[model samples]
Target: MNQEQLEGKWNQVKGQFKQKYGNLTDDDVTYSEGRFDEMLGKVQEKVGKGKEELKEEISNW
Candidate 1:
């Protein structure tokens, strides 16, 4: 998937998490987003892949 599609999927997942766990707040969602970014950064550093390439790999998984 492309960047927009990847982001749309992430938002859907985030929404589902919020709905399933009412206790989760916006801050928690923000933290999750940050963690995902960090993970992508680390993977890119190790694998030498572009951001879009990594995102597409994740989407395929």
Candidate 2:
């Protein structure tokens, strides 16, 4: 999904993120408003995966 769609669904997505990177704190999962790249980057770093992999993981969540 695009940044806007991702941002809008962040609440739901956060849960998925937690499931993958259980060590990420709420602050770690949440980006400053509009920081989609930063959020994704953090998730990427934690999961050691790229966007497509992350999307697939989230989709299955």
Per-model TM against the reference: 0.92, 0.38
TM-score of candidate 1 versus the correct structure, residues matched by position: 0.92
**Superposed model 2: Cα runs more than 4 Å off:** 1-8, 32-34, 37-61
Candidate 1 lowest-lDDT run of ten: 1-10
Tell me the spans in candidate 1 whose CA falls farther than 4 Å from its real position: none
Q: What does the lDDT come to for candidate 2?
A: 0.71
lDDT (10s digit) by residue, model 1, range 16-52: 9999999999999999899989999999999999888
Highest TM-score against the true fold, candidate:
1
